[model samples]
Target: MSPLADRYGRRFPYLRLSVIPACNFRCTYCLPQGYHANPNAAQALTLDEIARLLRGFTVMGMHKLRITGGEPSVRHDLTYILRTAAAVPGVTKLAMTTNGSLLTRRLHEWMDAGLNAINVSVDSLDRAKFARITGHDRLDDILHGVDLALDAQMPSVKLNAVLLRDVNDNELPAWLEYLRERRVGVRFIELMQTGDNLPFFRDHHVRATALETQLLEGGWQALARVADAGPAREYRHPDYAGRIGIIAPYSKDFCSGCNRLRVTATGDLRLCLFGDFGIPLRQFLQADDQIEDLVHAIGRQIDRKEQGHFLHEGRTGITPHLASTGG
Candidate 1:
């Protein structure tokens, strides 16, 4: 199979697959008002369907797969899905992004099933602040989960935090101090203007570049860029064991090197995060005879991938909820 390349000649090797859209936490930045799962959960792709889609993607040169969701762990058949995905012929790596509330119980099982790495979202380390931010008091559990992932000796365990101004932004120094001795890498992501979070984003969005400046001033050295660093610019401090990364989606347009495609839990193949364009793959997958057609359709969508998202230009397209898109 030929490598999947967009119009701009960027080859895609990563696929972000959202297995579920219902989360257990209502993080203020993501789901401030909370969410209710669709009553007809049957509308979602079955475990077998997910496996088939993953196999197709791997065949198309997608070597890196990241399982995501409103919270992927909430799915009852996640283990089965992970095991199936891990067995795909061409898949080189399997990772997951979770809220970490449930990792303490399932991290070991997931690791055993071939999960290569994990990125846990933790906005605040302060117990009370965590509860207020996520509408749940699971900070201790999340921290324990991170420790467990490190203890399990996973190749890479990262903590992903969305930087919110006047919220957890002030905790950067403290968070850095906490990670100084830990082995896990931490990434600070700038809040994106997607879905209903736009209003909240407008008020709390902090430019990751600003934070990076602060880190530089504080004595962190900019590291050489990894060829496949994705959207984050990584840095390191001589005194700290862990590395730091900053994702400036809104402030810095890192689209030229974008190498990923997203598949929503319901099987929509999104060409870009800030754009509404997508191919409804769920309908095609429902028909057994549509496998060939699905493959062709996926190729078409990849070819149509936009030059870049225009959120930085203040132009909003059909931005879906971050939960639905599994950011």
Candidate 2:
């Protein structure tokens, strides 16, 4: 397999593909005002186009593919999308990031279609607080579906929470209790500044260092990150059945180990989540024979990936929100 590495020696093995730019739920940190469809926006890539796109990625040795979105499960053809991704040669892991609202009824169907791993967004464990944070009161049902996924022996089951100061930041003890007997992995993502959320970012952003110190004092040991893992610093405790991960983007040298790339739903290659530009791949996706051009185009851009994001400099490139590029 050809390694898709940049001049900085970072190899890309994981690819996040946004199947759709629309989501059903309104998470305070991500989609606070709800998703507004752009009528002039290019329609999402077709199934055939997705298949061709995955082939180009697989040739570059990308083995793990995570289907993201505003919410991937909201797509009517998500099963086909998963199947197309899984069918690609060298693409061994087919996973998805979802709100998990449909997991209760569609988990088996998704799994049957070659979905082996899943990451669900669960911001707050408290039902009422969760409703306030996500604008949805399905916390109980979401957790129930997670339990069912574990019972079904799914290979990987994880939960993601965007840490907010004075909001859900104090719920670590409750999370620990929930993780006591479960093997699921929970990752707390630090709030990131995006193009349109400055006011909200200022009010709710919190550092993940405090949580790391708390975990260290509480006996959690750092876990070894696998080669194709996402950008999370994981930790494990001997007594607890589950593990914890922190995605502190503002932490020191955060992008030093970036092993992933993202593609927008409309077939644009995003080198950095916050990069101001996107190299259009739609032209190459028009035909199956265009794979060569697509691969070379991607390879050329790898050399252009910046050392890291400019969030520290108060620069959020073209991304207006997390849902825009499946953050």
Candidate with maximal lDDT? 2
Per-residue lDDT over 164-274 for candidate 1, one digit per residue giving the tens place of the 0 to 100 score: 898889888788888789988888988888756667878998777778889999999888865445577888898998988988876544888798888988898888877
Model number with the top TM-score = 2
The lDDT values for all models are 0.83, 0.94
Worst 10 residues of 2 by lDDT: 24-33
User: What TM-score does candidate 1 reach?
Assistant: 0.94
Give one digit per residue, the lDDT tens place, for model 2 in 172-249.
Answer: 999999999999999999999999999999999999999999999999999888899999999999999999999999
TM-score (all chains, Cα) for each model? 0.94, 0.99
- Once fitted onto the true fold, the runs of candidate 1 whose alpha carbons sit more than 4 angstroms away are 38-42, 286-291, 313-316
Report the Cα RMSD per candidate. 1.9, 0.8
- Which residue runs of candidate 2 sit more than 4 Å off their true CA positions? none
